[model samples]
Target: MSFFKAIRIDQRAETCDARYVDMAEEELMPGDVDLAVTHSAINYKDGLAVTGKGAVVRRFPMIPGVDLAGRVTRSTHPDFSAGDLVVATGCGVGEAHYGGFAERARLSGDWLVKLPGTLTPARAMTVGTAGLTAMFCLLALERHGLAPTDGPAVVSGASGGVGSFAVALLAAAGWRVAAITGHPAEADYLTSLGAAEILAREAFAQPGKPLQSQRFAAGVDTVGGVTLANILAQTQFDGAVAATGNVGGMDLPASVAPFILRGVALLGVESVRPRIALRRAAWARIATDLDAALIDAMCEVIPFDQALERARAIVTGKIRGRVVIEMP
Candidate 1:
């Protein structure tokens, strides 16, 4: 196709504007694989980029969807050929390069991963970046020698996309989960995703003692700041906490007691530029471990036109689960 529809964000002197427009194939950045994009997902970062809230968009005239899944229409890459089903997430797309918020995309072969046999394009985007990040946290904990017999695993921000997947993945692996959330009304929903206990966010939002009672064996921390600090303090000896987000705040405001005295490890999980091997491993685990029924339960499919509206909702904490944008 010569021209395709896309959501373009143009940076101005004072602010940036996002709108839908028809873009030429020449406007796409250089890459070896050309894809007819079928599905994209709205993660919190996408919301920030589309609404011009956070500093997520590093380039002007960007397409602001961080995750995309589609069939390859053409490829010069050795690992892939025409008609291959591929998915890409994180690699500075939606930030420094044109991304998935379009009917088509030209992306580097290195950034693309063939979808696991068990996952369809729509189901794959439902997992998207958030679920992938959650899986990374699980992998980190596993590498730290953690097991279900240690103690209950705690997940902060447990109602959101990452948090929801964290709870489900941990529980599926045999660990009882305590899901921490500010929205008590979602307790039942969280429980449905395999959360054994639902704790209020206030308990962890405030600063606590340097080393509190060890209630958890491990944690997947999605809300940084004091929440992470408290999670660290309450973790069992030799336990680990995987931190990935900074929605609460960037400051730690924590003590070294958890690290030095308890031998607790604070593992940092970054999905933006992970090696292809790691990405494949994570998706492989997802294929065998994650429940397809749970995936469907957590997904809301929307048409392309509603993406901007959903983007706003996600950043403001109004979205409960994952949202998939179906391309026209």
Candidate 2:
């Protein structure tokens, strides 16, 4: 049996710890394709899984990385062959199954997508699941009749992965972007991503009256709880808000005025279980719309062994931009 190094989380004396361990190919979960993983990115959920901060991992001794980009080494699936470049995000790759923290990965072909011509393996992982979620939100907003000329779109948690991508994509699409974030230091970073305005976290952090001043035509909210509810209340009449992350909190304290009187649409964006067609479309759009230089500016590459430390930082909001783990 061939052994490889993988970052595995184990329960030791009732305490969960994550570390790199030797693993064998036979120990990997059942799958049709085996990949030589070159890169993976750390997101908030990945942070949770690595640190055991939340109920993210359903199984112990698990490998946790939600996004992976690599080359296929072996494949039983007819659509894929050896040497094909591929990327996998969501579909339980890092959650229920072994993820990309290892030098190799085995996964169902159904969870894999051939890398788009516009993106390299490194760049794809730079975008990772967060960018995918951003693209999903953009598409949802567009489908909901949001046009570039509609008005300024607000992006909550604007300094984070999904929020940063949302700011860039929306601005690239010709919509003025107002980035809302708690990190004042990231204002310049957001502006460089095309955010026309940077809003302080206090703008939407506190509890506000339902249906307050209608400032934004639409919004892409990556923070749930009060921030999301405030965004809903502040959306212009006939506008919509795409709610993606629950980093702030899960409970939404909102009123019916925004839905009935203001006619606001709160569309949920879930990238994990998206249909294959939607996933393909979103990826294609990302390959075209996402700026590679901007992505590079936002990405911080680290050695795979540092994944656990980086995960802790991400969970505590100590890191900025995206953290991509380079596999051996």
Using TM-score as the measure, the top candidate is: 1
Residues 84-105 of candidate 1 have per-residue lDDT tens digits of 8999999998898899899999
Q: What's each prediction's clash count?
A: 0, 0
Clashing pairs in 2: none
TM-score of each: 0.96, 0.95
> Residues 160-207, candidate 2, lDDT per residue (tens digit)?
889989999999889999999998998888999999998999978889
Error of 1 at 95 (Å): 0.9
| lDDT computed for candidate 1 | 0.93
* Model 1 quality (TM-score): 0.96
Estimate candidate 2's alpha-carbon lDDT, on a 0 to 1 scale: 0.89
Query: What RMSD, rounded to one decimal, does every model reach?
Result: 1.3, 1.5
Residue pairs in collision within model 1: none
Compared with the true structure, all predictions reach lDDT values of 0.93, 0.89
